[model samples]
Target: MAAIVGSTPTFVPPHVVPPARAIKGLALIAGFLRNPLEIVPQDAYEQDYVAFNGLGPRFAWVTGPDLLKTVLLDESDKFSKSVQIEFFGPLLGQGILTSEGADWRWQRQVAAPMFRRQDLLSFVPVFVSATHRLLDRWRRSPAGTPQRIEADMTEVTFDIICATLLPSSDATVGLALEASADRLQRSAMWRQLYVTAHMPKWVPQPGARRIRAAVRALRASVGALLTERRRALSQPDDLIRRLMAAHDPVTGASMNDEQLIDNLLTFYLAGHETTSKALTWTLYLLACSPQWTVALTEEIAEVTGGKPVSSDHIDKLVLTQQVIKECMRLYPPVPTTSRQAIGDVRLGEHLIKAGTSIAIPIYAMHRHQKRWRHPNAFDPTRFSPMNEGDISRYQYMPFGAGPRICIGMAFAMIEITSILATILQQAKLALADVHAPLPVARITLHPKGGMPLRVWVP
Candidate 1:
């Protein structure tokens, strides 16, 4: 009965009404218990894009590009990022990702300069080096036999993040940091969903306990690293050092150790998880579509002249970019986004009351029948500049959109492209099994069972 664009407000059905069903308040909890990523039918997108009413009172399910624009752009001020992302507060502290209003703006300002084009360019060698290290590890495996590669791309991406953002000593702390990160990410997913399902945060739930433990471990590790960096006084230009030295423009105060740790943790967590999942999906897609793999191989060969792929050649790998984009379309790492209404607002015809949550199902929107021509098909051409012109901006938001869009967008693209280019150049991969793997959505959408692949020399 909602009024959105391209749809009639009045129902003119001349058929019998569907049977009534009981609403399951505990549906999300059950789903979490099962696999934490099982798609519930209640949460499934229905005709005209209506799904389950969110956990918040009077919340109406919002889907599709038009609704996404309304929430993310048109009525942006009425929506706050804090309400939807409160789950991150406990783990990341009051960092930029979880902050709102002026505080968030200031944090963004200080961090924005660090990810500029020049800084990103300087980090290219770090990416190149990490990729080469990974390839070397792969090469060490016995010859002729397919190497069973079950790498956690999260670990790989985290290694690169550490190398680029901090001093070399940070790499020594990487293994511990990575273990804590994985535990935190997994526990956060479960706890956030549980809390969203109306479970009291104070409850001594197993997931909540794990989340707390993970958060504590992460903070301790980051704190020790920050102390070491401050003491060593090395790598003045690195991100952690920069944050340690940043001054508040308005207040003329610098970030204290706690604030610095919080911001660093936020960046470290976000920087790697999404990009890692993206690379995992990209590799899986490459395995499924060998033609694309062959094409990517040839492109890498021509661009690198059979030499090692470097960040300088990243921009030239257009086909690799397309392949990554197509993979994102199918298995977006950040598959869902939400906002909380600050005042009564009318989205289409649906009256969303104050304090109501507005969920934009990026996963469903990307796969919507009317939105994408071949919604389920793996087509890299969809991202080609010539063909991309026809796609709506809101329809393909892997990193999100509008004023609060992801600040790490450029960094992520660079990492994915560079890592993927290097891998494809030196290796030939095949799916360990013929059956297509289902995505396991935790903090990010990951392939179930680690995307096992048989890797060999190209």
Candidate 2:
């Protein structure tokens, strides 16, 4: 195999197996904070299953491709998402991400139509326009100016979300919603990591007051918007409008204001955060691998013919898409997923007891030894047309797999490709710091401090 980009003395963290006696309460969490992949035992890359005993629960982190399929695809019903619901239900309410059983089925059906391929393709103009605006802002900062790229990506995605999902919303409300998502995510992560989930709400914890305030502000703003949209005689064709019209097919029932609010919040949080983080990490990898950036720029030029990229040109920009795919493989936004078994289940030779938390360690799986030729390296060629048939379906799940896969996968791909093409078309970005940004896992994977990249016109 050819030498992949970022294969030099770059910033890939090494996974290590902690000594038997070193595993203790909060130690794993602390280790994970230092390096997200470091917490995974080195043996997990080759092993089918690794049972971990923690202060909270006894869960098995399974890495076998077939075993992963069994959990995420084949036996999804047996492995319910009770554990995820417990972690995210408060912050997200009864949204799709937190709901299960009949409620989950109904929510998925209601939300499915809005993300269809045609509808998602219709969002291209919004994405390209947002990227242009972002570049305009960057141009004003002067050539070679150091900027926190992650925050910029977040701001750009936030704008796109507001334009496409809530066109009627103003800047002030959008800011409130953004702040609410950030606060609630941090608060929820802290609770999941350090504090007990069963702890009473009255028991004061870190960021409790701020979380409360942010949640209240977010609810009030979205509720007010819903009320105003309800009064409008004619509304624009956007997600808010579609959601307002969506009803349960089986029951022929419409969503009440609370359900509407929950779904809206879910879109805002998921859409804005995941897309921005993915872009951030992609740029980080680009900085470390300038050759791939040059290749992507050339591909963009040939596809656009030196003009602004449009929806019709999306398929022609294949290399740029591969770069984004490899970036997600290296640093998936939602790093790990855990599911609780509703009943006893047998995974291969092991018998998983009822209620056991089954962890599908996505990050580990992407880089597992048994999966790819060069799992740890940045190689977009792995996803090229000729190599697509060689890769296993379950081995590359950035957006997850099965019926519960991410609904926004298509939309996210279009958005990422557009934003990346637009950026590479005009400017060449390079890492501004000598050391790499430390990878941190919160609600989403983020660079610990921020990504500062030097932007120069190409």
Candidate 3:
């Protein structure tokens, strides 16, 4: 048994922060490139908070639950976003995720209703249909053949988002959308590094030209679709159509074409990347813990009762939801988020001065030794009915917390929960590789190569 387990490669080792010192200049950037997860020194974990004096900027890594609340939730306004995030501007434009102040408020208000419970409930069928399509394809392959689970999840989630938001797009258009987003995600890491180094956007770095081309293609495709939708005699009540009709209650203003394109790209990129990563990690964990897989499958069998999953049936899938919640806790889709102080801010005993960057290390926070018992262990029970209440509101922020929480939080949850239920109901999954996949951080956390798994009929 040890040999079978050992056959797979080592799990990506946790990066330990080097001893305290003045880490600055190119050394700082090199340290980050080596392992983004080691965002702070080992002492930071013991202390739960630490400040660093470095060349490029003065920053603090805050992991204490209360401190995170002050930075991300309570005193959020005092902490604006860091300039480093502008690396995404080329791909995301000035969408809600990147916008701030009144602009963010207006966009949120205009698009809020589209993600309400009732609206998401309407997407249940779309989720199930997309999952079934993937299952159909998987069924044709040999039962024990290795499958690239990461790519599979990415394709399915991408398809589901397109179906829900752009219902009229055909397979050809769907492929184009996928291609464009893939180009951006594949190149995002290097682009972020270049931007962080203060390199100009038009410097024509190695792959920058291709990435720019992909971004332009994506915008053009979305723009063409929007134009076509406008010319249609009647429009479907999908996300795109609804956004076109939505108006800001305060200003009574509607989103123009440019605004629509930016928001659509934001929704597509955000929703697609996070959901796929969540599903991939969930499956990997379940593969490692087959007993839990059996438990989840059994629970699905009981609740679903050999029928399709519906919105009404979702509420009863208690254990299934817990499994996903636990998976997210162990592997948050968006691993880390940072903010910069706009002015001097008092968080707990420390005074963070203006122009300082604050790292809300969500990845470290989830596994902080002081915060969660056996923080490294995989235990879905932590999120079970009886134990969930014990967790601090700020401690478990997979979709983040407070006002700037992910707008697609509800949509992503419903989609992930429904798809997990639907897939596990029809198949049993096992990791194809003997070793675990390495978790590499990019724009989102992804398995280094892909999550290879074997699918079989139970």
Candidate 4:
């Protein structure tokens, strides 16, 4: 492992201090809409499993690493993506993320080669240029200016995904998609509420019409871009071109227009949001921990040796990557994942009945008392090459585990490292205000309010 970066990091960044008691009844539903992390009882941070019976369906909250493996891996086949689909199906369609069974299998098979390590590495230059553009904008601001970094991160990541996956997107379409992301997330939350209460999909909710309109407009934009991608047959380097040419080997079939639109929207929305949250949190941590920030800045200089941060420097920036890993551990992008049982089943000597919902509150798991020495501290050494292997795969899964793991893991990591390295090389960012932003679970783990930081060259 790379030598420890300065002393052991002890600065505990702002985090969600879960409620002492679990909220129940309408309060639970209200909490779900407000911030689902609040719904996680305090003891989930210390215990393996917690059960609830009063909800419409039985709820099983599992944080035990061994049981988590069973639910997410060993007996994964016994669970269905019902709850997840109910939440995302309206927006994402039956794409790789919301689909299951043979349908999901074939889609994953077709999408696998697109994220090859070599192909993802080739995107490093694009990622760097995107970051440079954002930095240039920040540079225009006078010194001692607090930049809206949360918004900036979102914009840069969106640019990277669009450039690599959908170059055919026009400025208008791109802008519309960006504006609708938060609205769609809100709409999805209501969808989750409807499912939990056994309400029908067509039932009315707040802002339902506007959200539906946005969904229509977003799909139309992707559909138009997909059409354009089809016309540009020579551009085989991009994801759309590659997907257009892919076929299901068993049946020798290509994706239909709807399927193409489904997957394209899946990648466009899901691809960038997670990475943006990661970058935002990592920057927040750096701003708070001066020693690690200096250590990382020094390491970046050592790795690049004054040259631009290229793909070669990514692996060499071991401490930088460790900091990102630790940041993710402290604030996972998607704080919870869930599955509904296909039938009654036994997990760790507990009987989970058919139709029961199993929730893996990842935020709680990452900070469970038994998981680490100081679960909430911002320590990167725990993720260093030597110690990382000691942690169970299920315990530290920011991108998730098993077959349904995020397909764009490599793409996200490369973009994050490239962008972070470039930003540090160009300027220093520090917290603009003393007010600490608490973690909130939205579509992504958003730091409530927003993350504003002062950017200036040292």
RMSD of each: 7.2, 3.1, 4.4, 1.9
Q: Indicate which candidate wins on TM-score.
A: 4
Cα shift from native, residue 281, model 4 (Å): 0.5
Structural similarity to truth (TM-score) of each candidate:
0.89, 0.91, 0.91, 0.96
Encode model 3's per-residue lDDT on 20-65: one tens digit a residue: 6436666766766654664456555556678876523567777888
Worst lDDT 10-window in candidate 4 = 1-10
Per residue, candidate 1 scores C-alpha lDDT tens digits across 1-458 of 11112222131111111113213446646655544435333333333335455453444446567777888889898898654567777777777788877777888888888788656866777787887887787777764444434354766788888877755475556677678877876666556665555556676666777777878888888888887876784466777877877887878888987888889888888898889888887887787776677878888778888776666787888888888997888888897767888888877767777877666656666666677765667778777667778889988899999878999898988888888887887777776766456666666776665667777754
Supply the TM-score for candidate 2: 0.91
Candidate ranking under TM-score, highest first, comes to 4, 2, 3, 1
Ranked by lDDT, the better of candidates 2 and 4 is: 4
Prediction 1 global C-alpha lDDT: 0.71
Error of 1 at 360 (Å): 2.0
lDDT at residue 269 of model 2 (Cα atoms): 84
Q: Best lDDT goes to which candidate?
A: 4
Model 3 ranges with Cα > 4 A deviation: 1-27, 194-206, 248-253
> How far out, in Å, is residue 443 in model 2?
0.9
